[model samples]
Target: MKILTLNFLTCARKACKATNAAFPLHPRDAELEIVETDLNPLFIRNILPRIEWDALREICVELGLPTLPDAAPEPAALFAEPIVPADTMQDADEGAEKQPTQLLQDLHRLLLETTIATGKLVCGNCGHEYAVKEGIANFLLPSHLV
Candidate 1:
């Protein structure tokens, strides 16, 4: 499963629905794979506001990945230094081309290129383990857990 997906997922158990600890399921014995993917700066920038920075940082630490910044970066920081200010330019001939900064590329690699080939995502609140295989996460809850 992609790290990006974790932002929206939580413990499947109903009782853990409103719990603060249910989010950003902890990955255990994770087998990571690098799957190169196209970078989409616009999408990342748009979704930045919704990302849980602390949760993501925790996940990174648990997975033994590189640590992220303490705070989420502002959208404007994702782009390269433009010779011309964005507001003063047009889409085509009038503007300096906008490029993604190194940080943006790093975020793309961390969030999209990285995948879990096989692992268990354990919920902190309910102590439930969700299996991930072949990069697909199984969020199904058994009857008792449901």
Candidate 2:
């Protein structure tokens, strides 16, 4: 499986610029990295709810990646599983009606901090496989793929 891990610093910088938001923490170039994994059904099932499916699909298509089923039954089935941490659970209990800050933190960790150390990361929209090698992503695409 191909693995693709993005330089989080680069992504955040681009995002900040695009949204006109101040850069958080003045991150150095390539300092904070965001890695995308070529995950199996199981891993995808675990991550579906946390992910923005439309955005994921768009990225995948942009990268010429393989497409998944339009309806992910496995992910739906696994939605009830507690992907959040114990602290998040406590926070939820404390404020039943309010948004759980811990939950958001956990989501951030899963989506941004985790590294795609192994496996492939295909773009859902583009069907491109951004292979990861030695902690670097090979985003290069042939003319046809592009």
Candidate 3:
């Protein structure tokens, strides 16, 4: 599943529901695949406001993926400004083009390109396991859990 989806998912167990720690289920033994797609800057900008930066960073660290900045830029600034580096102008004048903003590239890579092909998401609170296989994360809980 897309890492972006994890931003909204929480543990399904009745005991764990509606808790901050229960959301952003911890991934275990994750087999990740990178499938690139056309980058849509607009979509990335739109979604920035909703993403839980700390949770994303934690999951990336758990999966041994490259970590993001300790804090994300303000959503307003991301949407309103280019955020070009100080040296980008010099590079541009030297006949080299500045690439997409680093934040945009990282967000796209993490949220779009990366997929959890095999793994299990464990609830931080209840320790319930949601198995992921064949690139699909099964979030359905047992009847007792429901």
Candidate 4:
């Protein structure tokens, strides 16, 4: 678990670094941060439509994330949020109007490019803790858990 924890943080850091590189004028030295969540069943239900709830839940549990609710909820909520600093955004030239399309591009960079460089991911279901090292997740299941 200790090794896994270090690996998770390493992955997270790499992801964060990649994300920062994709943005224009983004802070080069921003530190990566991880948030551990204890997701309730209602929250899981709310996220079902937008995300692969089963997969996410499984990963969460395997990584020791918070457990979600049993009954899936209807009308999942939007999970989109600005993960980067507003000040890091590069504005268009003096008279140029900002394009809406770029926003989507930025979001994509933030979400996909970022890697969980090093950290521990605990499973919510079985209390398994997978370690992320060098931006890699060791999700190998133990003999009993497998």
Candidate 5:
């Protein structure tokens, strides 16, 4: 599953849902894979507000992925500043549109390209482990857990 999915997932157990620790499920023995995808800056910009910055950082630390910034970047930072110099005044329209930046590419790698091929996602609150295999996570709780 994508890291984006993991960031939003909490403990399956209803009891743990209300707890602070349950939101960022801890991955154990994760087999990570890189699945390349086209970067969608508009999509990223739209989804930025919904992403939990701290939880994403914590998950990255757990998976030994590259560290994210201390704080999530502002939406405006996703686009490169249009560099229309006064010297090269020709084709001003070409530089007028915003372009995706390195930060956006980095975010695309983390949120969309990275995947957990196999792992166990353990809840911080209840210690219930959700098995992940073949990039699919089993979130169905047994009757005992339900």
Candidate 6:
């Protein structure tokens, strides 16, 4: 499933449902595939405010991908010289345009291109296993869990 979907998901166990920080369920043994697509800077910018950086960082680490900073990127910081490529920053006039585009490219790769083809999402608190097969995550809980 798309990593973007994880942003909206949380642990299904009744007890864990209310604990927002621990969830979106953590993927384990994930087999990832990257399907490149055109970047959408606007969409990335729109969703930036809603992303949970820590959870995303954990998921990235689980998927054996590069981790985002320990602290979340402020919306404004995305356009800063550090994130914008050095070449882009060299041309001050083009830096503004390039920064957002670069940031969009990165976010697009993370949230859309990366796919989990096989794995299970384990609840951080409850230890529930949600199987993912052929890119589809089965989130159904056992009767006891329900």
Candidate that beats the other on lDDT, 4 or 6, i.e. the better one: 6
Error of 2 at 107 (Å): 1.7
Each prediction's whole-model lDDT (CA)? 0.88, 0.39, 0.82, 0.37, 0.91, 0.79
**lDDT tens string, model 4, 88-146?**
55643422422223333322222333335566554333334666566555756556554
| TM-score ranking of the models | 5, 1, 3, 6, 4, 2
lDDT of 4 at 11: 19
**Residue 9 lDDT, candidate 5, scale 0-100:** 90
lDDT per residue (tens digit) for residues 65-109 in model 5: 988889999988999877777776687777676888889889988
Return whichever of 1 and 6 wins on lDDT.
1
Q: Report the candidate with higher TM-score, 5 versus 6.
A: 5
Per lDDT, the best of the predicted structures is 5
Off by over 4 Å in 2: 1-100, 124-127, 143-146
Which consecutive 10 residues in model 5 have the weakest lDDT in total?
A: 82-91
Rank candidates by lDDT, best first.
5, 1, 3, 6, 2, 4
Candidate 2, TM-score vs. the true structure? 0.30
Candidate number with greatest TM-score? 5
Q: Which residue pairs does candidate 3 place in steric collision?
A: none
Query: What RMSD, rounded to one decimal, does every model reach?
Result: 3.6, 13.1, 5.6, 15.9, 2.3, 5.1
Question: Compared with the true structure, what per-residue lDDT tens digits does model 6 show for residues 1-146?
Answer: 89988888877767888775448688898888887778776778788888888888988888789878788666775554435566566776665563454655788899988888888888888777889999999878888779
Quick one: RMSD of model 6? 5.1
Stretches off by above 4 angstroms in model 5 are 83-94
Tell me the TM-score of model 5: 0.90
- TM-score, every prediction: 0.89, 0.30, 0.80, 0.34, 0.90, 0.78
Candidate 3 stretches greater than 4 Å from native: 75-99
Q: Per-residue CA lDDT of candidate 1, range 1-146, in tens?
A: 78988888888888898999898799999999999988898988888898999999999999999989899998888997657766776656546557889888988898888989999999999889999999999988888777
lDDT of 2 by residue, 49-142 (tens): 5544444444344444455346433334433434556666777654343232443333334444454444444443333455555555555656
Off by over 4 Å in 6: 20-22, 77-99
